[model samples]
Target: MSEQPVVPDVAAPAGRGPLLEVVGLAAYVRLGLFGIIGQHTWDAPDLASSQRMLAIGLRVGEQQGRLLAIGASHGVEPVELMRPFAGVLDSFEARTPESSWWEGLLKGVVGHGVASDLCRLLARGLPGDLAAQVVGAMEYTDDDERATSIVRAGVEADGRLGSRLALWGRRVVGESLSLSQALLTTRPSFGELARAAMPATVAPEGPSADVVAWVLGELTAEHTRRMDRMGLAA
Candidate 1:
C-alpha cells in the first residue's frame, strides 16, 4: 500500500481470471459467513442479545446482496464460481469450531474480519473505480460495534473467559490467514489476476511470489489492529 496503485492494461479486463477469483473468494468467504449470523441469533443468551444479533444478521444480509451484485457486474455468478470450494466453510469451522455460543460470537468477528481484510487487500489491484466498488461493498456497519460490545462486556464480566477467548482469537487468526494463503496459492492465475488488476504505472512490487507474502502481511497487520481495538489479547 505504500506505493501508489498500479492500473493494469484494460484491454482484456472484461474477463480476466484473477479479479473473478478474488471476487469469487470474497463472495465465497462471505457466503460461508452468512450461516453464522443465524447461529448468533439462535444461540444468543437472552432476548435483548438475540435482538441485537438479529440486527447484525440483517446487515450481513445486505453485504451478501452487494457481493452478489459485484459478481454479476463481473459477469460471473459467484455461486457457480465458488462451487469448487463449496466446503471451505465446513473445513474452516471443523478446524476452529466454537466450543460455546459466546465463542462463536468471537469467531464471527475475528474470522470475517480476516476474510474481508484479504479480499480488500487483493481488491486494491483492481482498477480505480472497480476497486472502489469492491472495497465499499466490504465496508463495516454499526452492527460490528454492536457485536463487539457484547463480546467485550462478556470478557469484562469474566477474566477467565477473556483469557480463553484471547487464545481462541489467536487460533482463528491463524486458520483464517491459512485459508487466505491457500486461496492465493491454489491457482497460478491468481498472481496473474492480481498483476492484471494492478495499475501498470507502478513498477512490479516485487516478484509475483512476493504478492502473496505482501498480502498476508497486510492481512495480519489489519487483524492485529482489529484485535487491539476490541481490547482482546493474543
Candidate 2:
C-alpha cells in the first residue's frame, strides 16, 4: 500500500490574537470529529454513530456559547453577527427535507444537543451584565426555530442594508480566516488538511466577491434541486 503523504508545518507569526487561538481550538475539535465519524462508522454505535458525534455536539454548544458571549461583551447583537449568513441558513433549510430520517437525526444532534449546549455555555461565559441578555436570546428551546430565526434575520437585514453590513461581514470573515490560519500554523496535520481542502491561492484575508458568488451559486443549485424534488419548482 502507498504511504499517506506527510503534511508540512506552518509556523504562526508572533503576536497572534485570541480570535486566532479560538479558531485553532475549533479546528482541532472539528478534525477530531471528522476523523472518528469519517473513518470508524462501523465501530461506532448504530444508535448514535460515534463518540465523536457526542463530542461534536458538546463542543459546538461550547463554541456557540463563547461566540454569543463575545458578541454580548462587545455590545454587538448575536443576531446581527449572524445576519450575514442568513442566506446560507435559508439554503440549508430549503434544501433539507423536513420529513427525512436524516432531518430528525440532525434536529436531535445539532438542534437540541448542540444548540442547547451552546446556549448554556454562552450564558456561563458571559460577564454579569451581559450574561442575562445572551442567555435570553438563546432561550428559545426549539433548535430549528432558533437556528432559522437567527440566520434568517441576519440574511434579511444584511441584504436590505448596503456597504455597512458588507463591511461587518468582511470583518467577521476576516476574523474567522485568522482563526483558521492560527489552527494551520499550530497543527501540522490540520495545516495539511486545510491545504488539501482549500485552493493554493487562498489567503488568510477577507473573502472576495467572487467567493461569495461561488457560494451563492452552489446554494442556488442545491435549492433548485431541492425545490424540484419537492415538486415546488422545475
Candidate 3:
C-alpha cells in the first residue's frame, strides 16, 4: 500500500495531485458539525482557538469539494453518490433534536465519535488512497478534541446532567446503528464491502448476520470508551 496522503493545512499546499483524486466523504461530517457551530458562533466561542478551528473546518470543506470536482472529471458526480445518505442523516438529527447549546456540542462529540470509529473500521479494505483519505478525515483536530473535552468537563461537573447526557449519547449511538442498518438494507454494495472487510471470526459458511454483529460489537466498544471519557454512562 502507498504511504498515507498528507492534506496540507490552511496554506493549501500546491501539487495535491493524486491526493485530490479521492473524495473525502468524511468531509461532509465536518460541515454538518461545524456548520452547527457556525450558525451559532456564540455557542462555539469567540476566542482565537475557536476562530482557528473554524478556519480549519472551512479549509477541510474546500478540500473535500476539490476532491468532488476530481470525481466529476472521472464522470462520477459526487452528488449522486451522496444523495442516498443525506436523508438518513437529516432524519437522525430531526428525530434527536438538541434542546440546549451544550446538547448541540454533545451532538458533535457523538457524531464525531461514532463516525471516526466507523471510518477506521470501514477504511480497512478500501484502496490505499481511499483509505488514506478516510483516515485523514477521521483524525481529530485540536478543536475536535477540545470540543470533546468541554463536553467531558460539563458531564464531570454535574452528576444529574451527566446522567442525562449519558442517555443522550446512547440515543445518538442507537440512531447511528439504525442509520447503519438502513444503509445496509438500502445499499447492497455497502453491506458487501463491510462483509469483505470483516475479519475471519466466522466460519466460511457463516451468515451475513455475523458480520453485522462484529461491526456492532466494535462500534459499541468504541462508543463505551467515548462515554467513559466523558464521565457518562454508556
For model 1, how does the per-residue alpha-carbon lDDT over 109-205 read when each residue is reduced to its tens digit?
8988888777777787777777788788877657777778888888888989889989999999899888877767765655655555554554456
Candidate 3 per-residue lDDT, tens place, 9-71, comes to: 221123322222223334445446657656544555447535644664565466457546545
- Which pairs clash in model 1? 6-198, 6-199, 7-199, 7-200, 8-198, 125-197
Candidate 2 Cα outliers beyond 4 Å, as residue runs: 1-55, 83-88, 102-234
Question: Which model scores highest in TM-score?
Answer: 1
When summed lDDT is taken over every stretch of 10 residues in candidate 2, the lowest stretch is 84-93
Across 139-213, the per-residue lDDT of candidate 2 in tens digits comes to 433433432333234345555432333333333333333333333354343333333323346552334433333
What does each candidate score in C-alpha RMSD? 8.5, 20.1, 9.2
How far residue 25's Cα lies from its native spot in candidate 3, in Å, is 4.9
Instruction: Give the winner by lDDT.
Output: 1
Q: What's the residue-level lDDT of 69 in candidate 2?
A: 59
Evaluated at residue 156, the lDDT of candidate 2 is 54
Residue 174 Cα positional deviation in candidate 3, in Å, after optimal superposition: 1.1
Instruction: Give Cα distance to truth, residue 103, candidate 2, Å.
Output: 6.6
Better of 2 and 3 by lDDT: 3
